[model samples]
Structures are given as structure tokens and as C-alpha cells.
Target: MYRILCVASVMLAATTATGGTLDEVKTRGALNCGVNTGLVGFASKDAAGVWQGFDVGLCRAVAAAVLGDPNAVNFIETTAATRYRVLNAGEADLLARNTTWSFTTDVDLKVDFAGINYYDGQGFMVPKALGLSSARELDGRKICVQEDTTSAMNVAEYFKRYEMTYEAIPVAGTAEAQSLYLEGACEVYSSDASQLAAIRATFAAPADHVLLEDIISKEPLGPVVRHGDDDWADLVRWVLNALIAAEELGVNSANVDELKAQGTSTPEVNRLLGLEGLMGEMLGLDADWAVRAIKAGGNYGELFAKNIGETTPIGLSRGLNLQWTEGGLLYSPPFR
Candidate 1:
């Protein structure tokens, strides 16, 4: 009865929200997050059927901030073609999949991107035996790519600019493409460089394939929520910013509690940790919202290091994803 009343109160609060998805989420007792269709290091189930990866961290963090429970998330696997449709149809509350933030996807599709979570570029992969040193060398090779994605359009643009012709094989998802690529059915597999690396790591002979050094297109990947949900959007956006900001503030799971307990003198640290500001109240969350989110899976840097960092199987260097102080593009707005 206590649990039922708590959920009812949450639903009552959600009714006043800018979007109905929050109400639905509170009613269901979990956040429905759309994720990639098993893209290994980004979003994939483990041996125990637990969803784990970088993007999964985003979903769990958002759930923690809103519902106060990191595990209160139902991850729904979505395909490239069907991702936005699924979000628009209300099958998912948040699209935490590795979706490129494009003007068309944001404006025309009637969805708003919270922010760019991962700065990436489209690239290609080929067997080392192919001896393809550059993407330009694969003019006649058949390329495997997921359908209805920036990858396919980028492939077309790259080929057209070079005046090259190649066979484009559109697959339904990454698993099939990986299967075909491993079986030598497709000479090239193209996607975001991060994804290509992740997929390559999953290959039986990881050393047999190589990702081309040439990046063909800029892909600012991030989470997406439906348009016009100002309240929901602000909460989601700030939760992401909180993670990024916490990293910049030198706060992590290891030190956050200590920082909160000792009362940091830094104004931003106090504001972020809910000891000295009303930022969380502005977003309909408690003062400890940021703390909950950061503790859910550490700060942004920690999650990156754990999931797809240079030390991981993916071995991706934080080129553009590094903090601004470190000469990268990651910068969060002020907490106040």
C-alpha cells in the first residue's frame, strides 16, 4: 500500500508535467529507454542477459535522476529505421541509442535532441587482406550498412564526391551486417567510427580487420526525446549536463559523497551537489538529483573509461569528447 501510494503521488505530479511520457513512466514504475539493437559496446546484453554499455549508462542515469532508482529502466532494442518511429509512437520515453543529432531528425521528425553525447564520424572497415589503406580505394567493393541511417547517406555523399561507384547492401541491423562481413559477403562495413571499432572488437579474429583512418562524415550522436516536452526535456538535458559538469568539477563516485559531506567551497560544486542551489527544484527533481545521477554510474569520464575508452576493447581515444580544459569540445553550462 505504501509503494502504491508513492507511485500514485508520482503519477499525480507527472500529470502537471509538460509531457505525458513522464506520467506514463511514473505510472509504469520504470523509464522505457530505446537502445541500439545489440551494438556490443554501445548497447548489448551480456551473458546474464543484462544490458551493459556506454549508452546504457545514460539510460540508467536518467532513470536514477527522475525515478530515483537506477535499475528502473526497461531497455527496448530499436533499429536505425525504426528508432524515431518507435519514439514518436510512445514505445520509448527516451531514445538513448547512438542516434546522430541532425537537423532533420530534430525538426522534421518532431523530436528534440537533449545534447550531443558522443562526437563521431562515419568510417569504414575492411579485412586486412583487402589491403585497402583508404576509404577512397574501395570503389567497386560491396559495402554493408544499416538501412535508414546517416551512414548510408554519408556513403552516398562520399562516393559521389569521389565519383566512385560501389554496391550498397542494406542490412536490417548490425548483427546481420557483422555476420555478412565476417563471412566475406561484404567487402566493407561502414558506420560511425566508434561503432566500427566496437563491432570489430566483437569479430572472431579482431586482428584480421582494420578500420580505415579516413572519416567520411561528422556524427554528433546523443539521446532524443519527443518535441515540446519542455519540462521533460530540461530534466533530461540537465541530467546529462550534470554528468558532464560533475567530471569538470572533479567529482566522481569515489569522491562525490566525501565532497558532499565535507562541504566543498567551490560555488559550482555546492550548486551541483545540491548543498547550495535550487537547480534541481527548477527541474522538478530533489536537490540531490545530480548526486544520484553521478553516483548511479560515476561521472561522464568514468563511464567513458569503463565502457569505450582507450583501455577498453574499443580503444577509442577521447579526441573531441575530452573536457574543454583538456582541449576537447565537452563543455557544460553553469549550474547556477
Candidate 2:
């Protein structure tokens, strides 16, 4: 907890180096969100060319909070190699991609991770025919990994620490890596477990592949913004917190209006729903900001269940993503 505070303090200080992003975004009348090039269940276009997924849902929520219109956003597709460059260059306003938050990215890249929306870990996937049940079994094998990502670094460190030597087959993007892995360009593929699951679900024979039961590195993925815009950063962070708190407070899309109309004795719920607090005004928004956001696409859990839950093609169970009361890591701070 102390370490987390230290990191947050450093980020707060580091972000003081720039300013005025909120006014700029408001003036533009739309939020430009940077997302993955084509990672299914996170950010991918549907048949209608409309971006819809977990990450995309966050972008929409932010748009709704700021502009009162969830569709008032332009999703800018970014590769692992270009996400930071695009953000720092001001080409994108906020990056809601499944970007991992690390010390290097936070301090060195001069960007801030608003908050963690997904807690993931690195893992490997291989053909079921390999007869390998553990990552330790792959002593010397060719591995496909995406370049310019923590996956590449974590896998390298894992092999080194385990005293194993393997050839690295680097790919520029997820699509290329999937194609190569499917074509037998590499014997194994290493990435976040969620990504491996999402990718494997798209394969012709998903059951033919096996995700090894080994978690290599901690990956806290979330929304990112450039430095020098503390107000915008705070707004982004709190908007996410609003969604999370809404879920925890039992205020979802279906009943937000009803709850708001009836009024609540719960202070937290009232503050969250803009019922009896200046929370929205404090963020330079109208009282119904969170209402708009929640109405945009339900709450965080709803977005998750809709985009990548057990019923979806991604088929991801809310293992580490469940609310705190449900014994997972998701916890929202007090709205007051």
C-alpha cells in the first residue's frame, strides 16, 4: 500500500509538468481514444465498423461523462509500438487500450495510468499436441511474442531466470503473431492470459491450443493520459471510479434513474448518482455526469460481462476482475 502511494505521489508530481488538456478536449467537442490495433474483446470493430469491446466501452463512458454523448468519440487504432508515441504526440486524447501500467511507462514515458481496470498476468499458449502442461517444460523452444511490450521483456526474464534458452520470434502486432502461431512459425506464444484466451477463441480449432497454467508477470492494465493535465487525469480516474463504485453500491443502468428519483439515504450512493453532492461540479461537470456514463453502457461489470464474459466469444470469467465484496481486486475509493 505504501508503494502504491509512493508511485501515485511520483506520478502526481511528474504530471505537474504540463496542463490544459480538459479545456482542449471540451473545445474539440469529442474525445479521441487510442486503442489496440485489433485485439478482440478489448477493442475491435464489429461488422458495422463500430468499435465495441471492453476498452471501447471505457472510452464511450468517458465520452458520455464529458460530452453527454457516448458516441462522441473517435477510436484511434494504435499498435504496441505506436500507442505511446501517438498519445505523447497529442494525436489521441486518452488511451483506453489494454495498456499495462509499469514504472517505466509511467515515469519514463511521461504518461499517467488513471487507474487499473484489469489485473492480468503473462502466460504462454502452445498446441495441445506439445504434451507440455507447464511453462517450465519448454526448456528450449521457439516462442512468438509481440515487440515493444512487457510480454517480450517478461518472457525473456523468465527464460533467463529459469536457465533456459529459447529463440524469440518477434511480431509487430497481435494479428501477425496469431497468423504466425497458427502457421507453426513458432511452437509457443507468450502474452497476457486474457489476450491468449481472446486470440485462441478466434482460431479454427481453439481447443487444439492450450494455455499453460503459469502466470509470469503482474500486468495492471488501464486508461492512460499524457502528463501535465492533472485535472483531466483526475476526471478520468474518478469517472472510472464512478463506474466501479456504482457497481459496488448496486446502482446500475437499469435502476439508476429509479434510484435517483427516489433518493437514497446512503451518502456514497447519493454522491455517485449526483443526488446530493458536489462531486460532479468538483470535476467541472454537471451533476448528471456519472448518470450519463452509467447510462451509456451500464457499469464496469456490465461492460465486462457484455464484452468478454463467459457468454461472449472471449469466454473470460471474472476471476480477478470481480468486485471487492466478491473476493477480487476491484475496489473503489469513497466518492466524498
lDDT of each: 0.90, 0.91
Error of 2 at 230 (Å): 0.2
Runs off by more than 4 Å, candidate 1: 1-19
Superposed model 2: Cα runs more than 4 Å off: 1-19
lDDT of 1 at 121: 92
Q: Write the per-residue lDDT of candidate 1 for residues 1-336, one digit (tens) a residue.
A: 999999998878656546666667778999999999887778999999999999999999999988899999999888888898999888999999888888788888999899878999999999999888998899899999888777899999999999999999988888899999888889999999999999998877889999999999899999899875777888889889999999999999999989989988799999999999788888877889898999999899999999999999999999999999999999898888
Question: How many residue pairs clash (N, CA or C atoms closer than 3 angstroms) in each of the candidate models, in the order given?
Answer: 0, 1
For each candidate in turn, give its C-alpha RMSD to the true structure in angstroms. 6.2, 5.7
lDDT of 1 at 268: 93
What lDDT score goes with residue 280 in model 1? 81
Query: Model 2, residue 247: displacement in angstroms?
Result: 0.9
Best by lDDT: 2
Which whole-number lDDT from 0 to 100 does residue 202 have in model 1? 85
TM-score of 2: 0.94
Residue 223, candidate 1: alpha-carbon lDDT: 88
